[model samples]
Target: MPNTQRLLTARNIWMATVRPNGTPHLVPIWFIWINERIYICTAPESIKARNLRANPNVSVSLEDGNNPLVVECTAKLLDKPFPDEVVRLFKSKFDWNILTDDEYGALFEFTPVKWLLG
Candidate 1:
């Protein structure tokens, strides 16, 4: 597998969340890794955001098909006035300012509880 830190720099990671009725909601989205925690921004009304409100348990996987890295995490919705470091990371990685983006108003912080690497 690629270096964990390097893999995190990839443009998109697939996230899986559970719907209220028990089905899975999965999508590929931009993310940042800071201090071993994963952070993603999405629209407040997005499906993933709604699902996360109902259930915080989530699964995230890097895009590599041959050598995969998956993380099992418990996610939390971050309050406004987001951290400066998180803002900087997103700016440098995506060239988009999270603080200025109204479309992506909600931020989710994912803390890894278990990791699967192969």
Candidate 2:
């Protein structure tokens, strides 16, 4: 098996959440992997954020098709004054500060419940 950390360094990841009507909403998003959790920042009114507020269940996957890595997680909305480590990592990886960003202010932390790595 390949290193999970290496897979996570990809520029973007595909995340899927269930809408209120039980339909799937999927999009590619920038994310940071910390410890064993996935962290994301998006607009509060975005479809993904709204869906997660109603239903915390979510799925995320690396974009590479040859070596697939998928994870099922429960989403948690993080309050302002986000963790220092998370902020630093985001700056290092994406060079954007979520705290000062108005559009992508809504932050989420996803805890993996299952993993499918092939």
Candidate 3:
């Protein structure tokens, strides 16, 4: 793993997956590393979730050391609608007090399986 402070203190690049028709879907997302994996909160029925279900195969890239490191693998739903504790945890990271329950629910949960972080 890259030095959390050295490589990630200001890093924002994250792995984003999507299905672009017949072609493979892949893109980099700007994210925050929560707990042990990079995360994003999205609706379950969103395109991203659909694509992940149809094709678990995935790829990710993260800043490692002094350069960008890439990983190819799959992801599984570790959590959805994030648990209350998880939500509170993430909320602490941002000004979540202003958000309503439904607004907060818009953020979901996941974890990287077979991840490769340099």
Candidate 4:
């Protein structure tokens, strides 16, 4: 089983995406790991969202520097009327509802392809 405690309890994760010019854009954001996939919500016009639109490849790492957990993944933008489970998880974890908010741009699902933990 995945390390549920470590993953879900993490306060923040650093998400890195590739810019159109081949540079990297990284930011700290709230996330939830469910079913082996990482889910993050942000404005569609955000830099990370724009970058993901151009290139789906992404890297995510927990905030802890002493004992780090990183993963490489591809991001997929979820369509309107977001998944029920995703919304529920976000609510329980973050107490925020992405579905009822106009501030949230879109929900992005990141599927891990590789991991680096120490």
Per-prediction backbone clash count: 0, 0, 1, 0
* Tens digit per residue, CA lDDT, model 2, 15-116: 999999999999999999887788999999999999999999999999888888888899999997899999998999989998899998999999988886
Q: lDDT per residue, candidate 1, 49-86, as tens digits?
A: 99998999999998988778898999999998999999
Give lDDT: candidate 2, residue 85: 93
Model 1 steric clash pairs: none
Model 3 alpha-carbon drift over 4 Å, by segment: 4-11, 16-22, 28-30, 63-66, 78-81, 96-117
Tens-place lDDT per residue, model 3, 24-81, is: 6554443445566554454467666667767766666664446756555465655344
Per-candidate TM-score against the hidden true structure:
0.94, 0.94, 0.56, 0.93
Clashes of 3: 1
Q: How displaced is residue 81 in candidate 2, in Å?
A: 1.0
Q: Which pairs clash in model 3?
A: 41-108
Candidate 2 residue pairs in clash (backbone atoms < 3 Å): none
Q: What is the lDDT of residue 35 in candidate 2?
A: 79
Candidate 4 residue-wise lDDT, 29-113, digit = tens:
9998888889999988999999998899999999888888888899999998888888998899989988887777589999998
The local lDDT score (0 to 100) that residue 107 gets in candidate 2 is 95
